[model samples]
Target chain A: MIQDMKPEDIIGDYKETLLDLYGSICRVVLYTDIETPYPDGKLIVSTTDKNGIITHVNKSFVEMSGYTEAELINAPHSILRHPDMPPAAFKDLWDTVNRGEKWQGFVKNLRKDGGYYWVKATVIPNIRHGEVVSYTSVRRKPSRTKVDECIKLYPTLF
Target chain B: MSYLFTVSPDFTPVHLSGWYIFNTWLQRQSGSPIHLEMYNDFPTQRLAIHNDQVDLIFANPFDAAMLVREKGFLPLVKAAGVSDEAIIAVRADSAVEDVAHLSPGITVAVTEDPDVTMMGMIMLEAGDLNAGNVETTIFDTYVLVAKNLLNDSADVGIFLAEAYDDLSSIVKKQLKILVRSQISVIHHSLMVGPKLADRRDEIQALLLSMAEDDKGKDILKSLGFDNWVKVDDEDMEFMIDLMEALAT
Candidate 1:
């Protein structure tokens, strides 16, 4: 359900919580022009339950997200899901993964510092005993060209 | 009317035929026309459950929460004296003798079993590994997870203890178990949705008494169980709460 709502509508309460957690200096709920550079030769990885709650995060993921291990654990993955991303794109992603397929795309992720980072993400369903219990998402640095194409394409989708 | 029955997808590949055999026996015992449909993945099976297509299911501990709480599935039976656990293993020759010796940027292979993965990841903390420092690859089967380790595709592997035990001796020889979880309360259970609520007691009785007969004993062996036992609602609830706690 949170997937369909706009960021402004969803982050209002969340923003207040962040403000309380880190005081006014914490601007995680706000969008900014800053871009967190994806480290070269490193992959950011995380796993989530079927509902998209973060179950595990690699160090690269922690560094890129700007959130401590405690804050990110059990948090909805949508915390990093950027508003600039068209809802349709996410809808497509959900549909594909739910169908037990891998989904590949460039994502604009919101960091805890309010900056954003682009990633070439591959989400694969981990199926055991013929059932998908969770998802493992492996993300790497997206090429500048692909990021640019998504920046143009996502707007049209909106 | 006829009803639908299914099992969790994570059953050992060797037991593929056992489910069919049991389904046939169930039809005879219940005196009803029940169709068995085995879903290959959780999403499709969950969709089936969501659409009310499944009347009976033998579900894992994680999926049991949804069945009992969301879908009104009642606990019928669970395997006797069995609990699900996770084991962390590495290639026997790998230099990382202890989990603490492992470092960042290591690739960890795993499957979709949530309870196992949750336990596996928790165990990795000894080595200071988390999602951000280690790369994770999700394989479709435990055999693939073993293959990934054998071929040196992954530095470490998280396996369901049962699956790890089922691996060929040659594969097990090349690998060394780093750790195994001993949480003994959690396990899979056979449950019946609201549609089959009326037959709940009868089915439970049938399952619990299966060991009394030779044929039933054979079926039990095929499914990798000694016998079926009644599940205490409170114990199931506790496991569900534990799963929720671990997942977060």
Candidate 2:
């Protein structure tokens, strides 16, 4: 449905308000136990504006998310955010990136088909002239041991 | 959250420490954590602005257009009685005495200060010259542009008028100005982004009264300003519109 909508229809002037509305507008959760293994030796890369609006995503990212470019551009990065993720992990990620630092974690991401995949995500602030501009995120296949640790650790924190 | 503040990179070296002092004063005055970040060039600074890293800025007329129109930044104040103008110069011994005498294919050296470059190009129109006709080389700073002229690497140089005035007497002596822009309406302005919009009135009032005190006067002198004055919204809009026209 979002793909049928014009880009301008979803990209509004107020970024904060739109980010707040993304959950309700874009949520189509039909979760299954199907787990898609991360592609080998490939990176899923994406960049987002300071307000978390998706500016660019690589081919690997498009293939992994199973979404077309039209559905991703101007969409909030949170569209791929999994409901199973703990709030504390994201809070920590935001804190680190906001301080102009890099944050790395094993993340569970939701695919278009409501399947899930795990990634070793490293997010870095793209700075120019000593100012943090946008953010770049590089995701790779995560270690199964680390994913197993997170699967147990995330539940206690929540 | 600590807000980032920056000035246009065209400032002369003498005022570097003055900006630090001003930052200190502003933090104390506003009771907010403000950090000053200076870029060495326009492209890098513009990249930062494009990413929305800048919360407060003292920006040139050309950049002010993008900031106000596209980025939702509000003009807070401007240097009283000061305007941004461009100057076209050559080495004193050079045969070129007037802009009309300038020939095509002359190597023109310039910094990436957009407003000054725009004005310089407009002045070159008198010689029936345009960007296509002239060979232009971009330097990182006005000093480098001057160096290019003095070393015979460039036939002409473009400079910000204020920066030209701040040049040492020795450097000024070797340079001959063909023309200077007298458009007094365009100016650099301090603007606040949406993150700091709530404190806009408070910050504006603080800067307006700064010259009334001895401490603020000293700081203003170090920064080569007499005082900060309120910029009329209509005046700023007019300037931005003018810049948009020139850019197109």
Q: Where in model 1 is the C-alpha error above 4 Å? A: A1-158
Model 2 lDDT tens row, B123-240: 6755656799999999988888998999999999989998888788999999999887665666889999989988899999999999999999999999888999898565576566
DockQ of each: 0.02, 0.01
Candidate 1 DockQ, CA atoms: 0.02
Top-lDDT candidate index: 2
**Deviation of model 1 at A79, angstroms:** 40
Task: Tell how far residue A26 is off in model 1, in angstroms.
Answer: 42
Name the top TM-score candidate.
1
Residue lDDT tens for model 2, A92-114: 88899999877888899966666
What overall lDDT, based on C-alpha atoms, would model 2 receive against the true structure?
0.80
Q: How badly does each model clash, as a count of residue pairs?
A: 14, 0
Q: Which pairs clash in the backbone of model 2?
A: none
Per-residue lDDT for A37 in model 1? 69
